[model samples]
Target: MARYKNALTKYYVGDLEEKEANLRLAKWIQAVEDDTDEEVEEEAYYDGDGTPEEDVISVKKKYSFEGFYDNDDPAHRFIADLEFEVGEDRKIWFKQERTSGEILEGPATVTEPKVTGGEASEYQHFSFAIAWDRKPDISKSDDDAGGGVEG
Candidate 1:
């Protein structure tokens, strides 16, 4: 059996061009949540059987990130700036590197960050969600390509 550490996962954000220089590492992230929602339709036919048929109409993916606020971090700055923008005119590229070495990249729309109000003893924190503009591109890791290596 193979085990992986969550700390090894990496996240990044950049311009739509996807240039290495423009990519900013989101190292300040303390937690991340990936969500997938499926839209389904269920129908019951008047056949002899009393069973309902279900079909998945669509799938939506979103990632929510929470972390300590760092004013100096470029990725943090970029996301903060978007809080003032309206609509989806501005979109950014997002990339995720899993501990298993698989990669997922895609264009996404970021939501405004919700800053938490804490006591003097607590650190400042912010959380936001990014929704994929379309289906993300996934690249298999070398281990997965060679054989069955759990990610």
Candidate 2:
């Protein structure tokens, strides 16, 4: 079960690599190194109710992948990073990256994007579950000058 930390992790800033975005996270952000190859530690700010406030605007996560193209590419582009958008309100997209070339062969296609600017990417990711929200009662707030019998 994924924990909705009420805010984005300091590990992400729009779409930036961990190294490129660490500075952007600032003190409010939190991060840690994991013994495993996979990223282990991540931090996010919180509001009074354990939710991200206006000061916290991002709802995204960035993941990285680096391995040989294995397929055939001689240079063997590195799968730099994968970015994931927080929340399930919309479709999530991952940006593909290559450490050596602007475009590299992926699986059977060569359409994946490469690392550029500071745009973190998402080649792999999962969406946040959307839960039902409670409805508000506004009948009393409605202004009804006319009675049940209207001309």
Candidate 3:
């Protein structure tokens, strides 16, 4: 078991190798998802009497700005597009050929959105452990070198 002195940090990310890179990418996605987004809430109020003297019951307004992309391939350019996007203009086109592994990039609002809807939601609580370049089973040239905090 590779022991880390502290939780995952950018400092240790430099050592990540191959598959581990993907794992780190996944973690970043999770962190992004956990972040909250800004939201706008609208509320209305009414009273039994027309005058303010009467009791008034109203709903408090709150908005959740939290937003997250629905996709299995976190590496997809959509996430990057959302970040680099100048404004929240919905118009955008994401042309991608997974089979050919080719992607053509364009402007966000300038282009039409090729992204679709009907993404399945993740239900119930789940736990995930990320693994990157962790072939602990395979022996390395410098076996103990950088296995943990110590090189």
All models: lDDT? 0.73, 0.23, 0.27
Model 2, range 25-136, lDDT digits (tens) per residue?
1222122222122223334465355554334333223233222122222122122222222333222222222221122111111123333333256222212111112111
Alpha carbon deviation, residue 139, candidate 1 (Å): 2.2
TM-score (all chains, Cα) for each model = 0.78, 0.16, 0.17
lDDT tens string, model 1, 45-146? 898376889989988888888888777788887787777776654588878777656877888888867656677897778788887788878887665533
Task: Candidate 2: list runs displaced more than 4 Å.
Answer: 1-54, 72-151
lDDT of 3 by residue, 11-86 (tens): 1111111212121223323332112223344444474343334233432211111123335545333333444344
- Model 1 misplacement above 4 A: 17-25, 45-48, 141-151
Clashing pairs in 2: 6-52, 15-119, 15-120, 16-120, 82-121, 83-121, 83-122, 94-122, 95-121, 95-122
Q: How accurate locally is residue 20 in candidate 3, as Cα lDDT from 0 to 100?
A: 28
Cα displacement (angstroms), candidate 3, residue 117, comes to 30
Q: Which residue pairs overlap in candidate 1's backbone?
A: none
Clashing pairs in 3: 20-132, 20-133, 37-65, 37-66, 38-65, 92-112, 92-113
- Top of the candidates by TM-score: 1
RMSD of 2: 21.7
Q: On a 0 to 1 TM-score scale, where does candidate 3 land against the true structure?
A: 0.17
